[model samples]
Target: MRGPSAWSVADRELMAAFVSKVNGSAFCIGAHSATAERAYQDGAKVRAVLTDLDSAPVAEGLRATLRMLGTLTGAGTVSADDMREVLSAGVTRDQIGDALAVCAAFDTTNRLADAFGFESPGPGGFEAGADHLLKRGYR
Candidate 1:
């Protein structure tokens, strides 16, 4: 959400997908993965991240930031040293905040989805929307 306005839309979706996957929200992960694929002309990147965060081919800075978010979500605390590591990797304060926001948002959403037993979309459900957007030159 921070960073240059020209930051890749696909990357944002990838971030969302990554957060969803980390939170174990199948629906969001699938939906955002499809969204990112539609925006990037390749869904594999999203799939890869969903399957394995550390292996996802994102910028190193983003990887470090996401890793921090993961630790925060899992441990409920982000130390000053963690902040320094991400900053040293070139992540801006705004970017770090946005990453935290995304993580927090997804955590809430995941709990809601789980509590309500929200059903996941069927396979390929995201493709239709993604394909339509692609045709409209969203990518």
Candidate 2:
């Protein structure tokens, strides 16, 4: 499903990392950010997205999706204009749906992980885990 989306794998993973950060789930932030970094083959893109989404080196479509996801992390509902932003960026309805699915799933996972006191491995562990996931997949 994610493979066919307009947003690349790195973009989706970066969104997950961003959502984790917004939710303050340290475990998820470490894990997802490492995954995004590994998918991007480095940390620069991930850093850009996490540090300043507006200035991230991604396309307008991805930037809009990221912005929508950021708003999604809040307690309020997503407005039609948010969807418009994504659409105006050339993201298809299907693509937006995929992106929102990723964000929503991560939102639940981050909360669960935090509520359960899931401890993150250190930086080394994050990279190692990401490598394992890339090689073996989440299944």
Candidate 3:
């Protein structure tokens, strides 16, 4: 999740969590959601997005991007019209590219996590993992 990009670390983690939520991977969702909540220093935004995007209290660009990412994860591909929708919502080409990269990586990671039967470590472990990732990242 650590990279030079327009999205902050918290945003990227949220994207990962959203992707996992779409893929129905609870382990990935809980882990990344906790990381995102910790990085953002609040859970409200994360909870809102996880609950519903239409009124998620995030920027237009982010909502559009996340919607597109969610569609891609569910549909396995996004149409050019989807790209246009995101662009029309004010997400730049560079920003969409960055978000797409995160989506692609997490799509694979989330699938792998399911395939490997990864289990949730509960709240405390998720918090510790989040803290470690916030401090050191995924390297």
Candidate 4:
């Protein structure tokens, strides 16, 4: 999930998990959640965000981006007005673009995971995968 963008690895991972959650992709949710926890060094925050974004302790920009992505993933389209809301939350268009790229990638991955009936390997495997991702990234 590493890339040249303002969004940190933690944010990208969390967004991936969130998108997977929205798509009901259990494997990607657990996998990306583990990576996000490792990146943030705090698993509770990821749980909080998944449980409820409004109460989660994250930046408004990130929250706004997540909300926008939720709508996009759920609906398969993002209206210009919804994008305006994200931009109004002090999230620059470039940052939204970055977040959108992450969301788009995960959306496809989540779909493939569901279509193929992927399953979570287990908590330990998730952690190990997270370690690998944090160290090696997507390159």
State TM-scores per candidate.
Answer: 0.79, 0.93, 0.97, 0.96
**Residue range 1-139, candidate 1, lDDT tens digits:** 3245334667666776777777788777766678788888776766776677778877778788878877887777889999999999998887777777767877787778778987766756678755664456333
Error of 3 at 4 (Å): 0.6
Query: TM-score order of candidates, best first?
Result: 3, 4, 2, 1
lDDT, model 2: 0.86
Q: Model 4 segments beyond 4 Å from truth? A: none
Clashes of 3: 0
Candidate with the greatest lDDT versus the true structure: 3
lDDT of 4 at 74: 97
Worst 10 residues of 2 by lDDT: 1-10
Off by over 4 Å in 3: none
Off by over 4 Å in 2: 1-3
Candidate 1 error regions (>4 Å) = 1-7, 129-139
Give the per-residue lDDT digits (tens) of candidate 4, residues 11-88.
999999999999989999999999999999999999999999999999988998999999999998999999988888
- Residue 119 deviation, candidate 4, in Å? 2.3
What lDDT would candidate 1 get against the real structure? 0.73
**TM-score of model 4 (CA atoms):** 0.96
Ordering by lDDT? 3, 4, 2, 1
- Tens-digit per-residue lDDT, 62-90, candidate 2: 88988888898875468998889889999
